[model samples]
Target: MTQLSSNKASGCTGAISPVLIGAVAAALLVAALLFSASSPGRPSSAARSAKAADSEAAKRYHKDIKPILEEFCFDCHADDVKKGNLSLNEFKDDADLIAQKDRWLAVMKNVRAGVMPPPGKSRPTEAQQRQLADWVKYGAFGIDSRNPDPGRVTIHRLNRLEYRNTIAQILGVDYNTDDEFPPDGAGLGLDNIADVLTTSPLILEKYLKAAEISLDGALPSEKGREFSVQGSAFKGNNNATGDRLSFNGAPEVVFAYRNKNPGSFRVQMEIEVMAAATGTNETSTSPAASGIATNICHFVVGVQSGVAPLAVLLERDFTAEPKKHQFVFDRVWSIEPHVFKINVTAPGIRPAGRGGGGGGRGAAPPVGPQLRITNLRITAQPTAEVRRFFAKDAPPAAAKELQDYIRQGVAAFGLRAYRRPLDEPTLNRLAGEIEQRYGETGLFNDSVKPSLAKVLCSPRFLFRVTQTVPAKSGEPWSLIDEYSLASRLSYFLWSSMPDDELLNLAGKGELRKNLDGQIKRMLNHKFAARMIENFSGQWLQTRNVMKWTIVEPEVLKREGKTAGKPMLTDEIRQAMKDETTMYFARIVQEDRSLLEIIASDYTYLNEGLAGYYGIPGVQGKEMQLVKLPDDSPRGGVMTHGSVLIVTSGANRTSAVKRGVFVLD
Candidate 1:
């Protein structure tokens, strides 16, 4: 049996027990009996009976099934003419069909679906169709239970998107892996295809970095909490006077820092200094100090409440560097209200006698010397809310308590990260790493980051692994344990690790029973959107929308002719991608027919895409379902802007490419 022992199995609640073990001798005895009964001319009379039944089926296939195929299907599917690359000529008997199961299986699908025997052709009667399908289904050379095959899993690393999503789900950190990791190669345009997602030394390094970054983002700081706020709060600096001001994006963000608790604040500004010095100041880096260090542009960092100006750190005047570089302005200030205003001026320090710029009038933006803040990190003592978050995160001081904390924390985290419960050895090794790191520093939370990094970088977390068990009498292909099933279901549906519900079900071995409901629930989940994004993004080549230069239709590359449609911008390109993914998402979420993807009377559209497609009445930026008119050309994904543009050349459509996309 492949089942883990009850004592050895590990998960949140219970372990994955795929099959129970039996005595080897008893299993072999049963196998021998079963084998003898299935084989012809054995000592058992059951063997003769089985052989006779097989002969009877073959006789029926030749006498009944062969004529049926010849009369209806042979015109296009026999001898040299192989329609759909399938020929009845090759499968003269059940033996041929059994040897090449996939060929017959494909035919069976079409035949059962009433898809074969093309339109306006002589089709088989209901009885004949049933006979053909049933014979293929049951009467033919059927499954040899003794020699079952469930196929081998390629066991590849998650692609960049999956890695990102997995990190988000497991660590609560929305880590972006695309920027750091190399683009995963695609197999048949599908990025998640196992064999194509090969790991390399560079990828390992990327994983290592990703682990640390993910942990940093997920974990709270010791005593204080730190987080990255957007520099966009003051991105558009028209006045060029304020030291700090508030505004809004990883995307667009408008953060309001309000601290009710009493504590000093450490605000680290990743600022880039642009020095425009005049030759007046005595302070110089070299002999001449660039001859302009006399009238140096020093930054005034201040805070304000209404018009009453308050200097939080007036003694510190930041001077310009020799070259433009990101300066880390990390300092703790005894400031109140968690609010502040910063004064940024050009050449303000005129030998220590100069005043602020413009004298009440707005300072000109084209002024010399500029300081741009790219990242703003605020660190403050943990509030009650934050303290509650890391109540258990902060380790105890006592030796025994610390060890228990480490064990429990590491096991729980590893289970989540690895997407399955850790075995005893693995659990101990992981907890020991954290304990060792903590022993050196005596800071439990600090040590957890490296432990998390180690877990994230581990091969078990990186790859989709499955344990194997020996086949049983009638259960030769029961290889996917409950935990593995949970992982597979989660990755396919959510593009991440299994959530608690799934894990709970898996732990209790009830996941298989609730699979249909779980599938339905998951398809409607927000995470399922990732499936639409990643799968359709690659397959339809919509992810390449940004790279493709979409010009106005019918407008030539020549500079003079540019009057066909509105200017195609990046927004429109993004909308094009959104269209296909949303369409695919609707198919699964709404439980609509998959055929709708080919030719339907509905699609998703926002005002932008609607305007682009000449469809009226869609009035918002939010993409929503829009039913199409009978004659609307924008019925299905095949006609989507993303697919069409991707399959077309610039200002031209490739019939061959379009055909290949449709056929393939």
Candidate 2:
């Protein structure tokens, strides 16, 4: 018999009762035995048994099910009226659910399929359910159970777009990604719920993929001792039986030399990676972010001389995965020319590809592996610098110093309220994380720096927190935390972090305490500009004009008549954005009527957009507020190229879409 005392053996409702399981097992065994014995000889007994089972099922109200439902379902459905309806409290009798049989059926179906009451919810054991069913059949009554007490819920972090937008707002800079990240998993169809956003292995893979795709290819390159190296080996370790692999690469010693004179050298390389099924190990899901690819390798050119390696003249981590990887490092060395060594390292693992069927048993069979590299060449040296600047020294990592640096950044950018004043505990924890990663990974500075960037990019730092903290009474939540309040004010008004003035006010408890004064001061501050950029821009769909695609061939042909089909150019788009901002700024600063944006006589436009609108002789791309003539169809945001183009369909304008935009 299996002991049920260990915590692991316990059901989701906590401690399991051994007696319950024993009773359920015995009952099932006796019932099975009787059914087998009476088989063909007793049709009456079978009918009676079937009738009895139905009666038992009908008698089973939710109240009869112990501990499990109480721990899980009740938290959201019981007292919280704002959550989903259908409370388990009124389920005293089975007939009580007749009014909502559809809901009952849905619940039963979900329960049988193992989708609800959700994975993290309290799970009932099969034995427990059987025993409960039997007891209900025998006319059992509900026994009052102890209420469950799960720990307090923590806040969910921001999603990726929120992170990027917050950072861009904070820095007063543009940041975007060409690749869209996968949708985050949501509980109850809400990504903002505190408990829904989980940090899993799958989540880390998203981060890794995002880091690779978003990384800027701006590092400078160099040339020195150069050579073409090629080699290959089989998969697996230490001469153990494994799959055979054909591999080729430049010599590992190429990372030891430096370029003697300043000039440009173009080094070109290519690789090919292939996997062959040995017709054996067939049942394996393809590995993600792994296995047998030439692109996983790192290439380096060292500017070393006299074997004293004083400095690394040039270094860049480039991928050579099965395709051509090419780049030129101009004027890589500022010193005299010398023989330089070239080094290459390709790393990969072998496994089945993604979305494969399951395996039979035993160890999986190995697949044939192959990786190749060729077209190695050092073309010529550049006569001048390739990049505007380069920082060779190690960056600062101390917590206090970092805090100071952040403060300086805050001042330089003129932030309103920081989403939150990063507390000492948070800062210390982040610093510890940095030190730990540096020690464990020994990753190059470039890789290590992004870890800090990730920390800053996290939802905790980006989104304004709205957490409730209980007082020292160890009771129900009463007030929000200090950091929480800071975040709210920052994002709400400034759409960014709190500035020094606001931070000082927050420190003195004046910002939140004296609301009117802070609001007035913030209204006057430059941080208010973010409101025009983020909230107004989103509301106006200004950015969408850039990403929106118009595929209507007919419309394309029609528009292609003048200045290339009146496609919204960057110059034209900026004029529209400037027009909106200027109008909104006046609304806030000068207390002008907000309706003026839609009905004002004055409209802003640059030369490109002006000509596109048929208003001739407007020169230069600089935006200026110009008076709208009666002949001009342009006025307010309605006629702006940004709004008009985005609101249009592939072939023509969409009145419904325009109306919806206006309504929103």
Candidate 1 residues lying further than 4 Å off, grouped into runs, are 1-60, 73-97, 102-121, 137-149, 220-377, 380-393, 468-474, 551-566, 629-631
For residue 261, model 1's alpha carbon misses the true position, in angstroms, by 24
Alpha-carbon local distance difference test for all models: 0.61, 0.46
Per-candidate alpha-carbon RMSD to the true structure: 14.5, 27.7
Point to the candidate with the largest TM-score.
Answer: 1
Give lDDT: candidate 2, residue 287: 27
TM-score of candidate 1 against the unseen true structure: 0.64
Candidate 2 runs further than 4 Å off? 1-162, 165-204, 208-459, 468-479, 499-501, 514-527, 551-553, 556-568
Instruction: Indicate the residue-level lDDT of 251 in model 2.
Output: 25
lDDT of 1 by residue, 1-664 (tens): 0111112111111121122112222333453355335332222343454466567767777888889899989999888998778787776565555556566677678877878887888888999998887777555645445534444346656887778777756655455565567888888878888868776657765665566544544453354456565555643234432223211001111234543222224566665655543223212122232243322344544444323456454323345453433433333222133444554433322221333222222212222344555676776432222222245635788989888877777777777777788789977876887789778976665666665666676667887766544445544354567788888999998888888888889888899899899998998788888887877787777888877865564555455665764667777888888888888877866788988888998888889889978998899989888999877877888898888888888777789989998887
Top lDDT: which candidate number? 1
lDDT of 1: 0.61
